[model samples]
Every structure is written in structure tokens, then in C-alpha cells.
Target: MGGAMKIVLIDSNARAVSSEDREVSVGSLTRLLGSKPAVTARLPNGDRLLTAKEPCVDNGFTIGRSRVVVGAGVVVGKRDAVGAYTPPKTNVDTLTKLVRWVAPDNMPRESEDGRTMVTAILVDPETRDIRQVSLRSDAGSLDGAVGGRCRFMMRVTTADAVFVKVGIGPRAAWRKDGLVFPGRSLIVGCSRYGTLVDVATDIASLRASVEFKSPDAPDWLPPSR
Candidate 1:
């Protein structure tokens, strides 16, 4: 990848510190955490699961020097990491809200009206999740953007596939008329976890960018390096 990729950090609010970096490769995430995420708990069914709730903060991702420590609730993987992490309950609800807003209320929508089309990032009242926005499929000659907007949920552990209940959602602001007195932007603002605040740059293809060598990466999409 060249100097074409960029990253942005957000706090608890919709405020953001965007990136000017040229390229953010698929093998982009490099952990700066204290250790690999490890948590052990037995399920009520007598099963077990490991938990990594830590968030990606600062160079927690090697995108650049700038990093924000949202929390370590997310798992920290190896150098070439690939796994899924579900959004917190809050984000789950937020996602539900965004999906519901669309007329039919599906998901994985595209941006037809204009800016709200591609979801660069999803923002809650405070903090933002990179993968939590609508994706524009046609923009980069990519897949994933199937509906009017792209939405991914289910929060699988990073594997070969970025799995979710993907579908198209309605771009709420448009209706054969001009702009809705209150125009919408890419950064969606929300109140809780499942909600979203649209950002200016939603790189949907990255959702498909998995570590090239990781067997966990989705086989259909291009591998991330």
C-alpha cells in the first residue's frame, strides 16, 4: 500500500483527530498493549470463552504514532492479526437504531443521496468505532456495499470473513426532494454503543481486508497485507 491510507481517533464525543497518512495496509493493526488479550470464563452451558474487551487506543494500531486508548476490551492479536470482536451492548443497540432508521430497516446500505452514502466511521456521543459505519461498494470497485448503505453486525471474532447481518438501509435524508432541511453527513452521531456517527471517510473495502496469511480471513475478499 502507498501513502493513501489514513486513520482518525475519536474521544467519547463526536470530536475526532483524523489522519493524514497515505496508506493503512490490511496488516495495519499492531498492538501496543501490555499483552495478548486473555480472559477465561465458563459459559452457563459448561462451555468456555476467552474475552478481550480492551479497545484499540493509539498505536494500539500501527496506523501511525497517534493512538487513543478507548479501552482494552477488545482482543489484542499477533503481528498479523485477524479475528472478530463484537461491539459492546451499547454499540449493538446503536447499530439497531441506525438500521431501523432506514425505511425498511435492513443493513449494509450504500450512500446514494450524496455524503451520507459511505460511512467512514461510526460515532457515539463519545468515542467512535472504525468498522461501525455504512460502506460504499462502488467507490473503490469493491464488494460488501450491497444495499443503499452498508451495515455489518454480529461481531464475529476476526476470521477470514468479516461476518455480520449485512444489508442495505435507506438513506433517511433523501426523498426525491432536495435536502432535508437538516442535512446529514457521513459521521453518524449516537447516544449509546449500537448507535453510529457518520465520518467523512468510510473505507468499506478495508472491512474485507484480512491478513493475507490468516486462514481466518474471508476467502472471498482480497487478503490484507
Candidate 2:
């Protein structure tokens, strides 16, 4: 069922007298997110919701938690609606960290050859600094060409996020060359704090573009247009 409680609102200052707290609604959630709110919140459940009428999706990533679109903003939790003062489940703030913790076991394996695997995750945000990534294990042979078909035997080389259509299951395995994410990659792995798209799924996919960060980049993703 849909959640209740409208957090977003429209504004007006038509009269001379002041008033008490009133509810407001907005037409679009996208505009609200674009406004770049100062505060973002998460409820008791696993969703990463906001109070000031903002949508959640950004860049090529979605907040791992489920979201309920309220009046203008979104509420992240299990139930559709809850009390206004919903507390968080953990002390670990930040949406990315929340998602990484939300899914403790989302590491993915391929379906084709079933031999390749994803081992690490890293991020390079447009404005944020590139935090050093700690590899949990050795990801063997992430890219190559077999039978003239380019793919990762198992490797991730670039920092650009490879977008995918389906969410991966933890410790899940797929056949080799089976991951077909849109932009030059096909691997996804989960970290202690979140999931990551293996942008360097193969050699050819990375070689397909030249307009990005490095000459050796399998794909190119400038911070922003």
C-alpha cells in the first residue's frame, strides 16, 4: 500500500496575518531533488527517504533502499506510512553507507562461462574526492576476448559507473560474458557499505571509448557534462 503523510509543499504569502504549521504538496519530485536539499533522512526501515520533497535517484546510482513517493518528497522504510518522528535503524549516517550496510551479501558472478568474479568497488564522484577502495579478495581475470567476443574473464579497471538494468543477488553467479549493463561494463559487486558496478568488465568495452579520464580507460565518464 502507498504511504501517507505529505512532507512537500507549495508556498504563498498573500495576506497580512501569519499562520501556524500547514501541509504542502508539490507536482514533481525531480525538481525537488535538483534543488539539492541540505538534509536527507532514513527511517527505521531500509529506505533512504527525504523530508523536503526530493527524489532519490542520482547520477547512475539509486539509493539501495525502497522508497515511497509522498506528496513531493520520498519516505524510505518498510511500511507505506509511519509516524513523523521515525528514528533510524543504525548510527551509520550517509545514504551510500546505509545501502552498503543494507545489503551485506550482493556480490555477483557471471552466467556465461561462470568462471569470472567481481572483487572490489570504488567511487569517484564529481565533487567528492576519490576515496581509496580496499579490495576484499583477488578478482581474477575481469576482462578479455574469447572466441573474438570481448569480455572480462573477471576484472574491473575503470572508475566510471557501468549502468545495469537488474539488481544483483549476494554471492550470486552468472555465466561469463552474460552481464550486459548499458555503458561498457557488466559486473556488479557489493561492498561492506554498498554495491558497485564493475565498469571494467572487459577489455573491448573499455577500449570502446576515448573521451574519458585516462587513455587506458575502458570507458569514459567525465564528472559531469
Q: What is the C-alpha local distance difference test score of each model? A: 0.26, 0.30
Tens digit of per-residue lDDT, candidate 1, span 141-219? 1133322233332222221112122223432221111212111212332212222223323346433332111223232
Q: Would you estimate the TM-scores of all the predictions? A: 0.17, 0.24
Model 1 residue 182 lDDT? 12
- Estimate, for each residue in 1-225, the C-alpha lDDT of model 2 and write its tens digit: 222333322111110111112222232334444443323544555644443333343211124432212222344333335433233333333433323221213334343653323433222222211222222222222222011122333333333333222223321121123332222233334343334423333433323321223323455343332
Error of 1 at 108 (Å): 16
Give the range where candidate 1 is weakest over 10 consecutive residues by summed lDDT.
59-68
Candidate 2 achieves a global lDDT of 0.30
- Tell me the deviation in Å of residue 107 in model 1: 19
Model 2 earns a TM-score of 0.24
